[model samples]
Target: MAKTIFNTSEKSNFILNMTEEQYSKLASRGLIASMLLVPLFTIIPEVTDKASYAFSAGGLAVGGVICMILALIGMMKKYIGKGAVIPVIAMGALVLWGVISLINGYDLNISMYGYHNRGEGLLAILFYFGFFTTAAAVKRETAVKTLINGIVAVGILNSAVSLIQIFITNKHYQFVSVDDEAMAASGLSMSPIFLAMVLTLALAAALIGFVTSESKKRRILFICSAALFSFVIMFTYTIVGICGLVFSAAAAIAAVFALKAPKSRLVSVLAAAVPAALAVVLVYAGAIGNITSYRTYDGRIAWWADAYMRASASGNFNSDIINIDDPVDVYTYMNEKTVDIIQKNPLTGTGPEQLAFPQVRKVNDLTEIEDIMTANDGIFDKDYNEYLYTAATRGIPSLIALVLALVPALLIGYKSMRKRKSAEAFTAFVLTLSGVLMFFISCSSIAYAPIFWAAAGTACAAIEKPKKKEATEKSANKSVKAEKEAAEKPAKKNTKAEKKA
Candidate 1:
């Protein structure tokens, strides 16, 4: 059976060098990547990026996170005894919000099942709860490398698909998720924003790998992977995504310098950071391509301002809509319209996923405002600002609650990085930070949000592994051995003395 499984065609070198235990350990380590691969490669061919592909992929990834967290908990039951309480309380906020939405909420149907083409509702929040649970429950430090490997593989596959789409098909393909920004980048679930988030995390992991790895071949592999992820992020062209790579690279290199490792490893981190930095400067300066939009800063500010206005004041926007060419004009009007909504519904504002929908919009309960919204048809589905959007839809406390939930994991990863020299801890810290930052630019999608959530959990899990403990044990063993040797020397000396007498 072993011969059949291993392919007997290589008869000349049929003997295996690895013991069964070694092989088993190798296969076990691959489990995290194996489960993640199901979602990484899954794409519903018929729908493309419209709906089910993203939803299904997200569901699968969430399931995988849950399964791994449970398995890790079982393996480390004693480790979680005292640690599990805080995580449960932190994550239980999701259940609280979900129950409120179900029991006494506006439009229970929409709350339970989010609006069309968007699945970020009660269900999505619960899945996130699962992600935080992983962070709270997991104790395994060995799985960090495997998780990073899975992320790198997904990012590489994304870049490959995008390259093929850009060159061969002329920016038209359905193999991976495609969007209007399909020409910008492809593969995985989103266009520029979410795809950028995934690639950003991937680049961070690769740089971390470069910092941690000692072997020449493994170091080269990590640098190459970092380069590949950077190239894809360049095509993304979004400000946050591009800047994320540059800043995260700088941070990683700086972290390596701070680590006890030889200053020589900083070269690999620099190798990853320089090309990405150069690209950002050249492209913005019009050396690579005429992407004037990035240079003219007014456009993005106006875009975000418009989203804020839409989310904050659903009523006033339809009838008294002012021309938004001037950023100052839009900002002034947005502040005017949104204030009343906050004053009225401070505790639980409107409902879940109800932003920019006329039928369910509760920005103002005035009859005239309702008529205008119904007639005009609210077009903006998302506020593009998650902080304000969350406060507006879920209320101010909900947003605060969400932040509080993540605080523990962030703190855990941060403490680990500061107290000890662990590349895994720093990588998780940076990834979670990036995820939190991405919210300012875009909303969470099922496709890429898991990466952030998983990172948070992995951050909590970056404790000292058993090997470090064993090394300390070896030190203790050395003293005992020395004492035994010392006693034996006296016995041998006395025997010699007796023989001489």
Candidate 2:
């Protein structure tokens, strides 16, 4: 009988076709690109000013698009698996909107709009791609730590550079209003929004480190770094960032307590007091007005008031029922605008490129601005609202697709809570919670699509446990084969010995 040789090339081909590792690597690269792009975008915005926001919707935004492309390719090749579906759905919706905007634009014409619209749609799609891909590629627990560490490293470097620049230029003092010499001063920095986002990432990572790290050295370092970031955040006076941090801390404490994590009573007491401590800091910093508003929680009531009034007038009471806070009202107002736009254009919405156009038009006719006076409010021009931006621009189908993509990831996160002991599960829990916060804060935050995709990937990676019995069975089979071969070898040796004798 002739011995057969296994085809190594065929096995290699099979492995190459099946492994998620390649997709993961690409996903990590996408994340790295996004982080680097953040600072670069800040620099460009500072220098050019005209094209500052463009880079955000351009290069950094394109990262999400590329990620979606890679994810689609991976799915087509069968390497993506179930984890890729959410991103694909998000990307699909974005692409559909992009196509629609190119064709059925409601008289909003700009040579740059299509380019920017596609870019925006692509950007949102790419976020999901990078997020999901990272989840698929990296080990669940390790990826979360890596993401945190990466954010911390970026925050530290950015903060240090800003400090050094202020020192070197001898521009130690700056004014917030450009005329108020008595106002608080800070180093060279980007807009409040970008600064807030970085600080938020750093804060989240620091909280995670404080809770999970075993090393005294790392714990100390995290504390110092967190304090520095918090101080910087306050100096920036980005109230939104401060609010996010407070919420995250509250979330961390709640999660820890619920999990019954091993910790001292002192630690638990401190955790319980965190919100109060944060309020004190906010008051001491002079960032807030009227501390009693904090007690009644009336300080942030404007958003809900705006939402309820608008919803009541629109007769859209269903969406505005949760007017308990400014946050809910803000979310309702944003989503309602989108819901309104979507009712008109359900198939594609407004098109990815025109995300802000419809909202802008709804509020003002730029050509007729002199007649309307609505443009005087400035909010219509800026379009800080997310739901309105998406509905007016990307349309409703894209938003629906976005919701579908995110909901599954949320389910996965919910499942992860079952594994309360695992670090990966905790990270997913945090991300899912963050997504929820972002949703109520503004639909635009979750509407990015990429965040949700990443959330889904993290959820899947965290919850999908390996079966120990299957692994044991494989090990047992290999041992049995080895013993049988050994027994046959002795029989062959005896036959040879008898033949020689």
Candidate 3:
């Protein structure tokens, strides 16, 4: 009668009744699956023509949704830590701002779907959500290790493919063109620059894995992967790709010192530099000079100069001094136009779609800033710089939200590095630093943005240590130990007394 009243058999049927360890194990599987799928979906298309890049986006979305659901379930079960609250709120605010900006701005269809061939609108929001969910839910140390291994595996695979494309296929390292002859390893991405960004992050992950791993075999595997990634970066020959490597290396070195990790880890990380420097030397020494041209460097310098001169001239530079028809002229023009738009609409300047599309405006009797916007219509998809683009389109609120979303992750890493001497803390520091570097240098495309956001989330989740919980646990442990010691001392006294009696 008492057992029937309790209904013990039905208790197992309750979803929330699951233990924390059980929930964590379930969430870990989902996190690993998502991490694996993100790279597999991205890299498979480069090897096979049957699959499109959209499949990659689809895979990322599916993985993200799965992780998000699992994360919500973990939240219900109280498996996720309270330390994750700030990051969750920040990411949520970012998504909310994006939606609000889309609603207030121009074309609904474009804002929702993004531009042709580039689905960065609503899908990007989902990607960020997935990132946040994965970070919040995947709290177990085993899950974090699985994620790192997945990253290293992807990096090694991509590196092999790129090596083949460069050596066997004899393809050029092109950034804009899809022609097989131009880009050696496009890796299902639209450009080599994008692929390079992914590879750089993977390389960093591999280095972390190598340093933290105690197993000899695992360390060797990670070292091989790191070497391959370095080769691929050198072969890609994209300026941004090279810049990303520099940023990644800088981040790695900074993280090593900041986390107080072993100095040997720094040496291992910098080992990639030998190959990178050799590749650069080869390029300059005329071994690969024909394939790698310095024209792009010159063009970028000219572009920066023109932007500066135009801004200095208050967007009224004489056409005689600077050719209005030149492509470099657009950077200055767009910069000025973006400033004007932000000044007019500080809250919500325009929609996401408007930012991607051409915005024409007559500046004065002598100049008009329509050429660059029109030129960017189909040629160059984004604003090249993500921060400027976000500020111009979604206003200051969205930009602030986007920035805020990253801050908690960085703080988590910093705090972990300061407090913990474990490998997890070091890994979190490097991952966060890599994401921040990529955001500053690369365009925030769906392909790259998801990875960056996921890294941020994973870093946060890896180091979720609430002070109150820790204190309570320490106090409880101390009390139990004291009780045992006191009980033991009385028992020993009684045994001696009995022997004497």
Candidate 4:
């Protein structure tokens, strides 16, 4: 049964083994590549200039491609499972985006050549997809824990550097000095996404550590570290960065409450009191009023209003007319457009990145105003709208597929919730759900931020089995061994007596 159920690939001895010397060489090479490429991408123009292009293409892209090739090879050798579905779906989306761009595109040549091939554009997308796929393949909880630890370690090191820089240079940022020019030289500056991600991971680790820590010293250290990281996140003030931290905190608290309910009723009651207290404090301090002035929220409201208006004016359901002057009229208009688009292209969308529908095109035209032009020449600024972007980029089917991808993760979280597993897993699931909701909101404001990845990685990692399960299995095995030995002794004696007779 074992033979039929599992691969016997161990018999083939296909795995590569490295001597100490070979291992040393590989480690050295990896370090050299990291040192050379990190600063190169950090200081220079992001992913657009020649040097940046080469670094991303050769360093990041090549690394991802290598991983993908190795994964494929492993699959062929039966060393990896056929659960290669996500990568396939993501890659398929890329292909669909490309092909559809050609069929109904304003810029056919650029579309075919991979959107001006900017920033090692196509290759970079491929790399990230492969990187995610590799991450998904990691099965061991220890390995996942180690990866989270590494991120936390880096964040700690970077935070230390940030503190030093703040004191020595009298600047706030460490890895990326908050210099006047605002160019990023370090993780904190250049990759706020990475920074925010690490911050959340460190917090998550600290929470888990605190809960499980037996030693007072370790608990104090972890609690202090978590507090410091939270401070650092606040100082950075990347709106999304702050939001990610907030989301993570809320999720973590919620998970703790859920997990504590069964064993400690008093503690759970106290935990429940926290939100009520915080809400009271917020109202007292006028923090709730402060939320009204939030730039991101204000901007989104304005943008959505405008979109509703435009969609209504055109009498075109496919166009984004929801951003109109009259909310009542615009709302009516958008419903009509939704009905129209659903009637026309209910399944696969208008094709990836092809928003030539009259309504979208009108907004595309309006956004060309000098006041509204964003970094990407405004072609991608207002196009920042996610659902609209999804509809435009991959049409309806791909949009639906993206929604479907979201479902599995949520279901896993729900299942974990039902089982009353580790607090970390429940926190992760709720945080991920919140992050996904935030991502939808962010689609209209900011593009894909790194915090999304951080939240996602945490949520995915949280679903893993706890270390105690393995210990339990080992203990069960030991008990079984003792029982078997006791039974065998009696049988052996009878056999020996029979032979002697």
Candidate 5:
């Protein structure tokens, strides 16, 4: 042995020591880092004077590229499960159709860069890739725990910032605004609605953590975080935010009970509804601000009417029915114009470029309405509803593709929640549910979309069971522990014998 140290044998042993399991874990950690970084990127503001809408788009693009590379590596190492393929394929189809539409319409600048104030054209496709990649890449329990911890940490930070902005600061920041009477604690997001959406998800995550955590300290911390997030949501004064919070809470309650007691699901659902009902009562009773004020209700009603009018060929079309200066009339007119464009190219859509620079009626429109239409520098059409926006801009096929992608994930999350007996599973389920709710309520903001996709991916990734190799490692660890104990026992006996001698 002293004479011979075989280099070939040493090299062979080193190569054999590197197992596939180790490679999988390395890839999983990389994906976890990317996922955690996305929320942080949402807070970065666009400081440049350029017409770019999202300052965070560059960060998102980089994160997306990194996630894709990590996902490919996971796949190569066979870390990703079979279930991850569905979301990947569905998202891929959506991006593929969007690109095809862009090519057919052939407006390179607008298609590639998107319109000012809305940087979600080509860049948004990258987000979906990031989402699918995360879903596919994460396969370990440590990875799941790390992702949940990251979400909770960010949520707590967001809540703290919003609270500080509302209470201490009268000045405005990138996303925070405080005035004499009205206060919008946008935190890291420019839009109050977007901030609300993020807070809603955070609240859900906090709640899940509270319900699932067994440790006393962790439970208390999660409860405090949940309360802070809830306070932030109310202060934000966004109707959509309130609605989403109520919906997610109710869903989470029902999900928890369904898993714990399937037979009591209905009772649990009703119990969950109590908090929302109480809030509404408080609003109507003037104990709190009226969430359903005439102004808010009327505006939503007007938009719905506008969507209906545009989607149909009814003879009841009356543009002058409402005052042109009114937001309803302006939104209706814009939506009607969008509908006309969608009808022409329902399959591939009018392309991202045409949708960005829509041709609206120049004459016989109020200056105020015209101003609203041209608010985005006459370069993009704005739709509050995500589903309608997708259909209008990317075509029905693209919308359908998105639906297909979401539905499976939603179903998977729902099923997982019903069977969840552990904290990790519950966190994934609640986050997924919160993301789905946000998609329905909030407009597709670049700041918020990445968080949503990351949540969805983590949820999908949580479904993977532990591998055999991990169990083998655990057994090997136990065997080593036993051998060490045996060696210690003999040493102790020898020490005693020496003492007696």
Candidate 6:
């Protein structure tokens, strides 16, 4: 009866399949592998017609399958308590709405996989939900810091790729560029805009590491990495990237002031102003334009199969969107169209991946350049805003579920941030806060969405209160220490009395 609940074989730590610690480590390994490898994926355009973007989907599928397995295993085995699953349940609701939307959708193929270049479809959403669940359900350990470190590692590698491409040789890394934008660097990601968001995520984690590190070497390392990530983020020229960097840095500085700020409040204020000042100078100098528009609307290639292979190979298909001259125009038109899409279906609007070619002039022949020039119905694929996009695609309840998924973790993370809790908790808060805000203003893609979800899951894990077992162990240890002190007190008193005598 003593150990029957968890049968263990001798010389093995596998109890009831695997311990919670092992489960979490495996999940981390899977997630870290994707974070490190997914963005770096690429293939030559000559190899396949869909070479520009299919590899990313392949990476998502590989990573998603692993995450899904871990999530299902954890759910079946009851790795986490019932109370810990509220955020996950919220995520499940998002998935449920997505499926329902898919079922009611006009085209199963389009809604299931989304547009070709931008795959924000139901399948991709399912994968992201799996990742969020895996991250949230795992029992967080001190080793959770590794996830932050992994982002830093990705930042460093991507920075190196971009730096070399900028100063040394642009022609060297053709595979790195999914599009032909020579002025900006995209690292191994699909586009510079998407890469910017990823670097922002890395920058936030590195800033946290910099603030919390006590050792001089570690501080130097984190600061250098943060600077590198931030520099590349500027080159990407995305508003969300720049804003996230400044906000996350400022937030981290505020939190760290509790530990080791100069007594003068003036010094603290100046310290916080530096990041803002840098951003201002960069924007004013015109070094940073809105890279978001570079990948903006009018991308003609939506679905490619055997039928479109010849058309694609013959150079009839233009995969990029028609670039608008002004970012304001781009945002305005997309937002207006998004509203129309939402209004049309109000409940589970248009399904996931339903709207690719907005107000199409010729829906049948989307590839021809002649047709694309005349038929500019704002060629919008994904909506600029994530909140509106979620509501438009999944419906009002799904949007509420999305909010529920974030709000509780956000609230807990805020508490952890204010209290200056453990490094893990504070880092989680920063990750979740910055990532969520960044994506709120941008589209949800596999490129940046996974990071946000992973952050949310990590935040969920980090902000949990201590368990009853740990509380009991702590009390027992304290009582033992108290008894030992009581027993020793008389001996010390008698010795003192003898000396006095």
Best by lDDT: 6
**Candidate 3 C-alpha lDDT tens digits along 222-246:** 7777767776776654555676577
Native-structure RMSD, model 6: 6.7
CA-only RMSD, every prediction: 9.6, 9.2, 8.0, 10.7, 8.1, 6.7
* Local accuracy of candidate 5 as per-residue lDDT tens digits, 1-501: 212246556455432343444544654455445544544554543223342234455555666677776666656555555665687678888888888777766355656655434456765676566656655556655666666666667667666767665556522321221111333455655445666777777666666666555577976776667666666666555566677568656655754664453342233233334544554454455443223321222222223221122111012223355442254454555566667768877887766634533444342444443243433322234455566667777788888988887777777666655564556666676667666666654466655666667667666664556568689999999999999999999999999999999
Off by over 4 Å in 2: 1-26, 47-51, 56-58, 65-91, 106-130, 133-140, 154-191, 235-239, 258-260, 264-349, 353-385, 443-456, 462-501
Worst 10 residues of 3 by lDDT: 305-314
Which 10 consecutive residues of model 4 have the lowest summed lDDT? 307-316
Cα lDDT tens digits, model 1, 252-370, are 67667766667777776566666666655755665433342232122122232222221122323332465433434544444443344445565676567765543343435446433
Report every candidate's CA lDDT: 0.56, 0.48, 0.60, 0.40, 0.57, 0.63
What lDDT is reached at residue 83 by model 2? 51
- Which digits, one per residue and each the tens of the lDDT, describe model 2 over residues 79-166? 4446545644564565556556546664344312333212334434445555565554444355445555655665676566444432
What's each prediction's TM-score? Answer: 0.70, 0.63, 0.73, 0.54, 0.71, 0.75
| Whole-model alpha-carbon lDDT for candidate 2 | 0.48
Candidate 2 lDDT trough over 10 residues, lowest sum: 307-316
Residue 169 in candidate 2, Cα distance off native in Å: 9.3
lDDT for model 6 comes to: 0.63
TM-score for candidate 2, please give it. Answer: 0.63
Write the residue-wise lDDT of candidate 6 on 1-501 in tens digits: 222344654435344457676677787787777666566664332134556565666677777888888788778767645544777888888888888888877567757876555566788888888887777766755446777777778778777877765445443222222343334556755555567777877777777677776667976787777767766666554566667667856766765765453333223324334644564465455444322223322122111111022112111223244334344555565678788877878787777755543344554666653244234433444565788888877777778988898888787667755664666667777788776786566667676776667777777763344477799999999999999999999999999999999
Best by TM-score: 6
lDDT winner, 2 or 6: 6
| Backbone clashes in model 3, listed as residue pairs | 172-182
TM-score of 4: 0.54
Question: Each candidate: how many clashes?
Answer: 1, 11, 1, 26, 0, 2
Off by over 4 Å in 4: 1-40, 43-59, 73-99, 102-120, 154-225, 236-238, 259-385, 416-420, 423-431, 443-501
